[model samples]
Target: MRVQVVIIGSGPSGLLLGQLLGKAGIDTVILDRSSRAHILSRVRAGVLEEGTVHLADAAGVGARLKAEGLPHDGFSLAFDGRDHRIDLLDLTQGKRVMVYGQTELTRDLIEAREAESRLMIYEATNVMPQGFDSGTPHVTYEKDGVTHRIDCDFIAGCDGFHGASRKAVPDDAIRTFEKVYPFGWLGILAEVPPVDHELIYANHPRGFALCSMRSLTRSRYYIQCALDEQIEAWSDDRFWDELRRRLPAHHAEAMVTGPSFEKSIAPLRSFVAEPMRFGRLFLVGDAAHIVPPTGAKGLNLAASDVHYLASGLIEHYEDRSNAGIDGYSHKALARVWKAVRFSWWMTSMLHRFPGTGAFDQKIQEAELDYLTHSRAAETVLAENYVGLPY
Candidate 1:
């Protein structure tokens, strides 16, 4: 098979890029190692940056999001036994984020692509991009014991961190910067109303906790845990107890507890791969960078990456200009670094380090205090949370 672009992932980035390009009359194909059912079953964060919402609209999958996604103008930060609200809409000049799950967003993209009859190969095994440095690039994969090849002008590596895309690049060419946090987030999804209308990020003496929601009735909550902690060690009652202890009194009193339908521990890390491009192969989303969930920048950053990649591809096909294509890495990396910094900063401020001294704790408390009182600090949080512009 031959196409203009071969996207080696069916996640949001690849699917959204394909949808955008396909709408622009660009022929693209997506290949994924997972089945459609498996992809849809994966639970992930939903906080959508303003720029991401616009991109979803551009991809023709924003109707359901607009109808069902909750819009938040502000969120609260809990410290010193109180909740302090940051008015994001006011601080960011009316910019706000949408709470929409990644799973639902991927499902929407899948439906839109299928409706338009775009080709997508799921359960593609041993997918690899070859000859990306040459004028004629192609991808190879095996499916049902049969090997297949796709010839394309460009290859998009959206297959994520553990996928073949980034790994295909020679180690010498990749410069990586990473910091793994000492703690992980023990999270649970329950069928109950959220503690508040907007999310609450808590910096408690014991640990960090966050109260987020997928919908009005389905709440997602997380608390800091040791990196070595096991999900099997956390029962629903124990998890609820620890979460309540970390929250402010008022929020804790109002919180509802239920049997968790999903529970897991996600380790925090900040990672970025320099350049984000290797010849005809472009790295997008998790394939290039990862940020701690503290700032909720992972999926949003992926959307921005897709924005740059799609724009470059569109420019190459339309005006026959290589300018955007040539500059894709520099443009995407510039924005990726900023998001990575913000995520790292937020994680540092909120979570307790394993060996934190009294001095360090005092400094963390002081920073939170300043953030609550200073409009400037709040504005920075609001602007980054809503997104830094694509």
Candidate 2:
């Protein structure tokens, strides 16, 4: 089979990229090693940056998002037994974030693509990109005991960190930088309403806690815990009690507790692979970089990467120009590093690191205090939180 582009991975990045390119008259075939059910089952980020919202619209899947997604003008930062509101809209001059779950957005994209009969090969094993650097690129994979090949003008490595695409690059060609945090976030999804309308991020003596919601009726909460903490050790009551101790008295009092439908522990890490473009194979999203979820930059960074990749591909196909493609890596990495820095800073400020000395604690306290009282520091948080311009 022959197509203009071949996309690996059916996550939000691959789906979103294919949606944009398909609308531009560029034929794309999506290949994923996992079943659609398995892909949809995973719970991921719920916050959407302004850029992601527009990208969803461009992908023709924002109607339900705009209807159901909550728009938060601001969120609160709880520290020193109190709450400090960061005015996202006011600080960013009307820019706000949309609270739309990634799973729902993926479902919308899948429906849109299926409606148009886009070719998506699921559960395809041994997927590989070939000849990405020799001016001719193609992808091959195995499906149902048959091997298939797709000739394409370009390859999009949207498959995540462990996917075959990034690994296709030689070690010498890609430079990697990574920092794994000492703690992980134990998150729970409950049917109860959130304690507050907007999200609350708390920095307490115990650890870091986040009060977030997927919608008005569905709440998502996370608390920092040791890397060794096991899921089986945490029950609904124990989790609630520990969460309440981390939050302010009022929020804790107003909190609604219920049986958690989903629970998992996610380790924190910041990783980036240099030069997102490996010849004709352009790495998008998790294939290229990962940021800690502290600033909600993981999916947002992926959205930005998709934006750059799609724009470059469209320019190449529509205008017969390589300018966008030629500059893809430099431009994408420029923004990616900024986000990595922001997420790292936020994680450091909010979490209680292992063996953090008294001096380090005092420094963290000073930073939080300054951030709460100083307009300049608040604007920095607001700008990064709402997202940097695409």
Candidate 3:
């Protein structure tokens, strides 16, 4: 099969990219190793920057989100047994984030793609991009014991970090930077209402905790844990108790506890691969960069990547201009690095290090103190939390 673009991965980045390009009269085939069900089943971060919501609207899948997604104006930073609110809407001149699950967003994009009868190959085995560096690029995979190939004018490596797109590049041709955090987050999802209308990020002597939600009735909570901690060791009761210990007294007292339907431990890390563009192949989302979830930048960053790549591709086809495509990496990476710094800073400020000295602890306290007392510092937090401009 031949098409204008071959997108490897049906995640939000690939699906959104395909959706935008298809609307522009560019044909794209999306390939993924996981079934549609598996992709939807995976739980991910729910925070959506304003720009991401706009991108969803542009992709024509924002109807449900518009009706159902919760819009938050501010969030609490809990420390020293108190709540310090960061007014995102006030600080950002009326910008706020949408609290909609990534799963739902992906489902919306998939349904839209299916409604348009766009080609998507799921549960394909051994999917790999071939000859992406050359003028003619194609992708290969095996489906139902039959090997197939897709020839395309451009290959989008949205297949994520573990996928074959980035691996297809010669090691010498690519440079990678990574820092795996010493701790991970133990999280749970329950059919209980959140403690507050807005999200709360808490810093405690025990560890770091985040109180987030998928909806008014569905709460998602996470607490910092050792990287080697086992998920099996945490029961619903224990998880709730530990989470309570990390938050302010008022929030802890008002919190609702219930039987959790989902539980897992995820290690935190910051990773980036240089350039983002490898000749005819363009890396998007997790394939090119990853940030610690403390700043809620993962999915939003992916959406921004789609914005750049889609604009570039559309410009190439419509205006016959290579400028956008040529500058894709440089432009995407500029925003990517800023987000990386913000996520790292958030993680450092909130999380407790294993063996830090007294000076380090004091500095963290001072930083949080300054952040809450200073409007300028709070604005910086609010601005990044809501998102930087595309």
Identify the runs in model 3 with alpha carbons over 4 angstroms from their true place.
357-359
Query: Residue-wise lDDT of candidate 1 within 6-105, one digit each (tens)?
Result: 9999999999999999989999999999999999999999999999999999999999999999999999999878889999999999999999999999
Per lDDT, what order, best first?
A: 2, 3, 1
Model 3, position 378: C-alpha lDDT score: 95
TM-score of 2: 0.99
C-alpha lDDT of residue 73 in model 3? 95
Q: TM-score for every candidate vs. truth?
A: 0.99, 0.99, 0.99
Each candidate: RMSD? 0.7, 0.8, 0.8
Question: Which residue pairs does candidate 1 place in steric collision?
Answer: none
Q: Show pairs that collide, candidate 2.
A: none
Q: Tell me how far the alpha carbon of residue 42 in candidate 3 is from the true structure, in angstroms, after superposition.
A: 0.8
lDDT (10s digit) by residue, model 3, range 1-390: 999999999999999999999889999999999999999999999999999999999999999998999999999999888988899988999999999999999999999999999999999999888888788899989999999999999999898889888998899989999999999999999999999999999988899999999999999999999999999999899999999999999999999999999999999999999989989999999999999999999999999999999999999999999999999999999999999999999999999999977777778878999999999999999999999999
